[model samples]
Target: MCENAAVTSTDGQQSPPPAPVVPLTDAWLVIPLFNEAQVVRGVIEEARRVFPLVVAVDDGSRDDSAAQAAAGGAVVVRHPLNLGQGAALQTGITYVLERTDANFVVTFDADGQHSVADAAAMVQAARDEDLAFVLGSRFLQGPSPVGWLKRLVLKTAAVAASHTTGMHLTDAHNGLRVIRRDAAARLDLRQNRMAHASEIIRQLGATGLPWREFPVHIAYTDYSKGKGQSLWNSINILVDLLFS
Candidate 1:
């Protein structure tokens, strides 16, 4: 009987008001999903609140990651076999380019390390600055919260990537990036593993498009730390870049 309560229908049934509609942005979030069943759905749901167009490429996850992504209102593309993260990313990007008319594509991490706010800001920066690419940098504002060893490896990788790709990047391996449609169309990622991070920088640098690094804070949660690459894997990435 409250003033704001649901109204009773003629049949004595109550009907509630419809949910409010949220206007979606023009950008699509392309997330390369693996066996992140515990967190992928939450990440996708949170992202959909800002950017409604989300595509999650499942790289043969052993768990129900694809289903969860679908439930979170994302377009789920499944890979029969367990391809690497690069392949999943390529699949997501291709899906966006071929299916949608989005103006920008954001590559977000499925493990929840990347911030949705940062992604939004990067997209805004691209629009305001007329940038073709906006890459995330953890070292722009100040030192990241990572340990000395991981920081050293990241710095070395950034230096090596800059030397090879002729693009100065402070955080070359950061997974969060906002790429305009024209610039994203030129990306042809061949590396199917961790080396794809460097490969992306190389390809983007080859485009000669205007790009800038935006300061982004990465949440080094226990879950993300568990899924982080080991020292040996980092060494392998360096070797791959040196040889490739």
Candidate 2:
């Protein structure tokens, strides 16, 4: 949780990281799709512009999510049954680690809530800092618009997670993240549902992997809002955390 200013990439003295000379050939963007027919293709197409490899995990969606993702030129992987987002992410990461020569992987949202520019920054930051994981935080420096009650609940959950993980995170549930191959190898996420977020943080805290957070914008459109977690689901996440 503490920033080690002394360990930064320094050519001579304290300095910024050099430009990304290292090609991102093995770095893949993973988008877990669950009936996101309207925006899945668009997201994959845009992501392909920044990343050469894009892996979409179709989490047993009833709709044509897998077809649309394939049409968008992403390597589509399908689960015979509807697994949760966490399971889908694990499946996609495993696919890259085992199927390709990927050294890094990013878990991204398929609902068009995430931005490509921010994701690029995160990937660069992870490389520069030699970090295991880099998370995107809406509270970093952007205009995060959420309802008062929803905001309060989310904030409370984040605080509780920070206490549990000792990471002092600004946003705990953000889906935008980058994980290096080494870190991905270390991660063993058990939670298959929303609680997977907490599971990730807990594991990172236990392992004490070098982690950082960057600013990113999360657009809450009417469609995104409709697809977002309900209040009851949030409560269920808390309950799961308490028991597990």
Q: Quick one: best TM-score, which candidate?
A: 1
lDDT of 2 by residue, 98-206 (tens): 8887778899989888988888888889888888889888888855786665566667778988998788888887889888887787677778888888887777667
Instruction: Give lDDT per model, in order.
Output: 0.89, 0.82
lDDT of 1 by residue, 34-113 (tens): 89999988999888888899999999999999999999999999999998988999999999899999999999999888
User: How does model 1 score by TM-score?
Assistant: 0.87
The numbered model that scores best in lDDT is 1
Candidate 1's clash total is 0
Candidate 1 residue runs with Cα over 4 Å from true position: 1-24, 228-236
lDDT of 2 at 134: 91
Error of 2 at 39 (Å): 1.2
Q: Judge candidate 1 at residue 1 and give its lDDT.
A: 57
